[model samples]
Target: MIRTGNEYREGLKDGREIWMDGEKVTDVTTHPAFKPIVDVRARMYDMQHDPAYKERMTYRDNNKTNPVLYKLPHEQKDWADKLEAVDAVMNDIGGVVTRVGDETIGEMWSLCDGRDVLASIDDRFSDNIDRHIQAVTDNDIFHVSANTDPKGDRSLSPRDRDPDMMVHVTRETDAGIVIRGAKFETAAAYADQAFLKPTVGAWADEELSDYAVGCIVKMGAPGVKHICRSGFAGKSRAADYPLSNKFDEVEALVVFDDVLIPWEDVFFYRHTKAAQYVRSSLHRYSAFPYVLRLLYVADMMIGTALWNARQTGLDKLQAVREKIADLVCYREGINAHLTASIAAAQRSPGGLLMPHQSMLYAGRVFAVSQLQNMMHIARELCGGQICITPNADSFEADGSGEWLNKFYSLNQRWQADDRRKLLAFARDLLNSDYAGHRLTFVQFAQAPHFSHLAAVYQSFDFEGPLDFVRKSAGLSDQVKG
Candidate 1:
């Protein structure tokens, strides 16, 4: 069931409407803004077929081999296997790229856990959930998520304002339902499909609402328009901004102009309870991979700072070593949460093993909330040269090249070209425009700061603290009731 690199590329030529930088992109696989990221995704597929990586990236089920990333988790070992697969891919690609596939598939698993709640509304909806989960594994599909809607005028209700502000079921047909609205999706332009759902709102009190609907959306279907943001690739030489050139995952505002959702694809409709269930439990499994990406990011920061210190002989100072230790603490703090969550994993309502909810959510908050300060520390260690240093061309020019060589060359071990290359890399990672965008992505991509705190608030076991204080202070027994 594993697909090859070319097969994955050929699937994107299905006449999907995509626009970027005031012009239409004819082919996403070849477009300058999207081609580098597309190739990174394609290389992941190709790795599954390579002899050296085949055993690590895929698993055998019966007689057929399937991607380990897409396999449904049943035991603790299954999660360990998935973590290993992600490590192999990130190391091979040389950079981190979320929303490729593994990070979004767990959104479906979250739906599977709520089948009983969905069945109470309609049994057919529960059946639909089971079928879609299998389809992704069988077809080797690339799936993404659609949750944030463009809600206009917070003071006015969706019905009072523009009803099209949120995705809603406009009308029901014998074959399916028609939907109208827009959603902000990260990788919808090149993804095969998206699990479209309602955004966060006051849906718990409502019994029935058009905005409370969830279903599967085909990316290439009619009436779906992908209006993408300007990309960072091809705007500058790759020698200066390597991460932006290869790892920019373009976000898009997808306009669903009365798109059709067939009956088989509909998981829930016109039900507020289902919507609330999905909103609360959306990242049950997905947050693991989302937070895991920050671990690699921390490593990048630590590596950049340490290499710069070694180049300038600043590592010999005690104060410099303390700063490096601070960076190490941030990195290990994230590592501790992830490892403990797996060690104390829990079983889901659907009989699947999930990372311990409180530990995972706490890890997400720690990793995302402190990213800015961590980047600042690394930037300080790298020095001001990262921002003022000349590009590669300046170092190769005739007149300026001689002066640049004399100033940049630190020692025989640290030559001019190597110093320039390191500075360029540190610039892109910590000081470039792309760096700011990445910081924002880590903060708000999963949700905002308040939402991360909310997850921790809801998942933590408050009763443990309450009981300890009550016993220590010798409070009344009636408080227990």
Candidate 2:
């Protein structure tokens, strides 16, 4: 069932312990650090109810209204519906949001794909994934993800190091598995629950490990503490930092202090093979939306850079136009991959329509790997004025306003106010603290660069090239052995 904005906000008031800047945050719905993004998420819920957007954002299924993004991808249209739903949300909210339901929903499908393998370990584990996936559509839950741990020593195994460095099961009670440890997660403070699991495929040689556990951890559960990093919302005026003040998704180092996970919530526990399977195929469907978000980020750069060039009449210059063209090509490269991935969609193991694997993963590498260089190109196009522009306060001050007006004013059409506003927006988008944090999140938040290449390697069908070269060389049948 779909929920209203007020209903979603009410859910966050279950007394989850959230801390930021050495103080407790009583209400994430109102806290300056968390409220902005929380409102954005809430607005998305509200949009699903609005008549204008209900058609695009949700659909009727089984005689019940469910959010379009949560529906499992049984056909190619499912993926297309999801893409349009995400676009609708971003357009309504005025920015790109990664962790809110769309990007993370497909993760459970990873578990779905591994159903038979997990059933080999425990039948209940497979059932748990199915039940949880349904519950998401039924209850309209806002789920996040948790995987990375605080790695103290890269060389030491979990047993050789401080046990708390990795999230692991401590004990199994009649109630469920009790977990202890910490994880670095984004949006943990505001979301309803997280699919907590291991970070990677390497589980060492251990057949059974306490660290190889996956389950649903409620954000409001007892003993679950959210210690958040400093957020960018309240530090500066919105006029100077528009994106940060309104759409900052706060991250937290979530600590699980003997948190009890219900049996139905546990996907797998103490099975290294299960953990390996989960990690290896974790991003199969999820990565499509993750890479898709960059299309918006790329658009922001192109729109900002082109507007700056247009306002100043630099579009006439060949070099300036070429730089704009470069940004366009970058944007379109991402578009082409997403388009092809869909056009050449493949049927996954679970019978869902997954985007073409090689295209999707390769597209991820292209978008993430080239982000900084593209940022620099945008920064260059914006000129040095972005960094040197006076704060909004100076533009509003009586004495400085006159001087700023004279210098910043470009023409009758592009007056000082409009020019100053554009410069401020460009500064926030390309050079501010928010910009740098976003760049880092884009590169490392999901997985690192090498891991992207690994996915491409693992998903590619290399036999075609191998067979071609073999047939051409004429000695391959004997030599291949």
Candidate 3:
């Protein structure tokens, strides 16, 4: 059931309502803003079919070849396989893409691990999650997640103001539950289905609130509309913003105007305990791939800085070497965390292998929190030339071409055209508008920084440190409570 790139593109032509730049988009696959990233996604699907990558990208299950990324993890090799598969993809695509199925698929896997709690609320809910997980593998659906809602007037309670501020069930039909509100999700416009859930909050406070619901939302469903943010692509010249044009994954504010979620698709409904359980364990398995994306980001930074240093002959300077070392440290820091997390992988409640929680969550915190500083260090190493350089047009123009060539050609080997391309690449990576947006994107990709710290707190065993201190200080059982 592996899909081809063209098949994946055809799936986006199902009359989904998508708006960008104040106009309705007729075809997401052809639209300039979405197509590049969509093509990236489609390329990933096609890679699974290519013979050279077929072995690396897929595995045989029940006499069918399934995507390696979507397979349920059973042991450490499963994680290793995922790592290798993703590595193959990153190398193939030449960039990092966060929401292209693999990263978000694990969110449902998190719910898979929480089936007991879901079954306590409704046995059908647990069964739904298991089926959806398999469906993504069998059908090769491009799945994403919806968690955060556009909570307006947070000072007032949901009932006090507009209840629609949070996505809530407005009414129930024999067919399904009708939902109304909006969620801020990336890649929702081009994705096949989203595993929608309640936003993170005090789920313990309300037992049967309409807001406590989880379900599968088809992207092309009748009342679903995608009002997307203006993309990083199409606005800038491709040469000036290469990554922006090629790798910008457009995010959208998906409006659910009385959208229907069929009965079989609903995971939980009016169940606060289920919501609470899911909120706590939501990113358990997904955080690995999410954080793993940043490791690649770190490599990009290191690669950019190292190349810039070598091109400018700054590598010989002691200060320049120290800065490059700093970038290397950041890259290796992310790598070490990922490698160790896999090495110390744990088993989830539902018999899935999960990266060690402490290491994975801690790695997420370190990677996300330090991303901006690392970018700045890279910017400094690439030198002020990244900003002061003229556009590609100037280098290729008549009079300026001669002048730029004279100044830019540093040696017989390092010429004007190569230098311009390097600067443009570095600018787009570390200094362009796209660069800033990507930095912000990584900061809040899975959740927020506060949520990351909370995960670290919850996952880390405080008792172990407490035991050590208690034994060292001879402080006793009285303080244990």
Candidate 4:
């Protein structure tokens, strides 16, 4: 059941309680600051109904009557096709869908349902899995995952920190529960309905059960407030920074003031151990694809960096070519690793999980190692041009127009104004608040951080290689014989 982009936009009009700049956001769908983002999300929703995209964006379910398209890799080629379909849609534009809504949250939910984290709750989560999956697919929502707790102080546990710093269940009832506290660095708070999770890292003990509460609530629900970071809220003109204008990935802090969540929407309650289960689902299913997305991003950066170099006549220079090659190496390394992750994937009895340790480790290892390389390439290729380029407004101005043109033009292939625009865009990509988002993806894309990488690498059966080495060394019979 795919919704049209118009339907998707109209759907956001539902009044949700949201706050920015200490004021209420009365209408997210139509608000100047939020409208374009809603439109972008709507475009994602509309993809399913598009004749060209329908087959790829949606798939037939096991019931074979309904269709599903999600991030979970399938053993069958068609299922694999489904993964590619979803990736192709989101990965373009670097997966920076302005506001994180269904696409992002649904992927995490898919992870949870696929891994049986939510299913373990008396099959309650499993029952709604299909329905929830359908709802998100139809809507094409972007999910903003909020997993990090405001630790208050680095030394304290969540309980030791200001309890208000951690999102927790302050009250519970038969109907549901009320959660109080804040989730920081939420990438798409205004766009998503109901925050998902076990609320960061909670233990299994009864004392921590309140923190285990997890459920979905419509955005702008009674007591929820969204506080945006300082920046231009509305769309800026092309004369403004290209990255800032066309594709701002909005990140905000959210406050939940005793927000009520219904029981049906709740996946975990008063079971602290369930938090790990829920997280296991999210990190594996949703987060892994994000790495794949970042790899695509690296590819984009490489191309842009190379083009900027060539535009500057640095393409013929050996030093510049070395930088380009370095970026390509990182790009290819990540792509190859993700390809392996997909190819080696399997569906466990628990659900679809990408536990190919070798692949996961390789993905993470290459992710952080290559990020600096890409950033450096951008720095070397563009140098001062990115920072010093005149804004689009300057070029449009009559007073300095001629001088700007004479100073900024590249070869005759492109005009001076166009070259300046590209430089501004490249600058934003290389350095901006939103650019920090890329680093965030690499740093925290996996929960438990490097531990997950180490676990995957450690769990790999290296014995296969050890045996081969023994055979090559002609010592195979020493132990077996």
lDDT of every predicted structure (CA atoms) = 0.92, 0.91, 0.89, 0.62
- On lDDT, the stronger of 1 and 3 is 1
Worst 10 residues of 2 by lDDT: 472-481
lDDT of 1 by residue, 247-312 (tens): 999999999999999989999989999999998898899999999999999999999999999999
- What lDDT tens digits, residue by residue, belong to model 4 across residues 1-481? 5566776666656666556667776876666666655666666666666787777767655533223444344455644664566565765434344224422544444445543555665477555555555555544554465555555785766667778777788886887778887775444444556445654453654544567766665665778767766444354564555555545555567777888877666666666656756554454444445566666577668777877877777789888888888878887888777668667775654565454646766676677656766786777777877777767777778988888988887668867866886787677677765566656645664454565565466647778877887898888476542
Residues 1-481, model 3: lDDT tens digits: 8899999999888999999989999999988898899999999999999988999999999999999999898888888899999999999999888899999998899998998988888788789999988899999999999878989888888778688889999899999899999999999999999989989788767669999999999999999999999998888788877899999988899999999999899999898888887788888889889888988888888888888888888889999889888888887888888889889988888888889899989999989999899999999999899999998888889999899999998898889888888888889999888889888988887888898999999999888889889888999768882
lDDT of prediction 4 = 0.62
Better of 2 and 3 by lDDT: 2
Error of 4 at 405 (Å): 0.8
Query: Deviation in angstroms for 357 in model 1?
Result: 0.2
Model 4 residue 222 CA deviation (Å) reads 2.0
Question: In model 1, where is the ten-residue run with the lowest total lDDT?
Answer: 472-481
Q: Per-residue lDDT for 300-411 in model 2, tens only?
A: 9999998999899998899999998999998999999999999999988988888999999999999999999999999999999999999889999999989999999999
Error of 3 at 288 (Å): 0.7
Q: lDDT of model 4 at residue 466?
A: 76
Model 3 regions lying over 4 Å from their true place: 477-481
